[model samples]
Target: MVAGDRILMHLQGRSALVVGGTSGVGEATAERLVAEGCTVVITGRDVVKGRAAAQRIGAVFCRADVRDVDAMIAAVDTAADLGAMGVLVHCAGVGHAARTIGRDCAYSSAHSLDDFRETIDINLVGTFNAVRLAASAIARTDPDELGQRGAIVLTSSLAAMVGQTGQAAYAASKAGQLGLLLPLARDLSSKGIRVNAVVPGGMDTAIYGPEGPSEALRRAVSDAAIFPKRMGRPAEFASLVVELLRNDYINASAVELAAGTVQLPR
Candidate 1:
């Protein structure tokens, strides 16, 4: 059976807000949430893709960048208005492809500070923005019989732990997610909120578009895996997110879904 078909109705009567749910893992997770009988809201900067994805999943589309505090609050409110807010999956982020130093003749072309800042703003800071606002709204609601009010799943990357060349900024931003997982879980535990992170390995997503990585690079990466010798499917990532939501005992953990692939110098 497909990933959507396998989802348990654990999310019935609850609501989920997927920040960056327009495509890839985010879109897959949104679809799974809907399959599990949750009212879902998805947010993204791309109106065309966001609306289309939401329509496909029968979810509400909120056009908001995760970096904007007011916009994130509004997105959270949209989900809460649907039902008791219980799930938040943050998947809005960008990839950094530029190297810390350019390979030009003079070697004067270094990665701009602005570029580094932008990566952190969108990936790290934006995630924190969504988490804080969403958790606040969730905390106001009463916990379930299991004493759990909400679950948050943040997307980290394998780069956070073992990044390849040209991934300094990307890896740092993802590592910042790891930094947030434990503390946020502890801080929100008193309110019956659970926070966790997923460090996904190379996945075949829009993040690496048709023009992104070469076929050889992709194959070599797949060959390095311990098993499941291929790029991960978005559904695989989504399945884990759903499991984390229903299993309350899985708080403050950073789960890796890379099939044991390791990073080598590019």
Candidate 2:
């Protein structure tokens, strides 16, 4: 697609909802939507980040936690009140990594049960929950000239395919998103809606642990001699998402932005 080509969706006069748009790829995509003429609403748990992102992108901000069904529903309702939603971008996700056997999984010993379950709740179930709610609103909107009312672009990690030594919970959560796309595609086809996902490999995002690499995690990522050059930039991930949301043909699937680093285990 050339720069001269009109953006596939042309988003002008339409509304879009971007969850987790407070930072990284989500924030960037939201800005692009506004530039292309869409009224955008971005949600996140961070009020400061969310407000800053919205202000920067010329869009509105609605604080939300994807795991909170009520919060997501409110955000969706806000978007609908603004206008018919032309796009739904779910870029909200969090990462977790721990050697499965070593980490304390038991809540019985006064250890927190929050870690593993929270990852799944926020990254996997949250995506699923928000998509259905967004679809409900999108379905209400009449189709555009091409019979497309909206498209949903979800975020998953390369870990979805690459089950490293760690990331047991994170990988499982992300993979769930991939599993949902095809079925979601079929389910939403008649409603003029589409679902898809972006899988990013090792990124330069601040999600990196403060203490740096865990011994086991390091070996796992480097074991295949992949990503040896360096981690990928956040912008690289953002661009593909923009393309997917633009093209109506792209739906109910996932595109990996990882640099061929994640070879599926045989």
Best candidate (score: TM-score):
1
In lDDT terms, how accurate is model 1? Answer: 0.89
lDDT of 1 by residue, 8-92 (tens): 2257989899999999999999999999989999999989988999989899999999888888888999999999998999999
Model 2, backbone clash pairs (residues 3+ apart or across chains), number: 0
Model 2 Cα shift for residue 189 (angstroms): 0.6
lDDT of 1 at 147: 66
In the range 160-216, model 2's lDDT, one tens digit per residue, is 877776678888899999998999989998988888898877665556665654555
Best by lDDT: 1
Residue 206 CA displacement from its true place in model 1, Å: 0.8
Model 1 alpha-carbon drift over 4 Å, by segment: 1-10, 104-108, 210-213
Backbone clash pairs for candidate 1 read: none
Q: What TM-scores do the predictions have?
A: 0.93, 0.84
Q: RMSD of each candidate? A: 4.3, 4.4
Number of backbone collisions per candidate:
0, 0
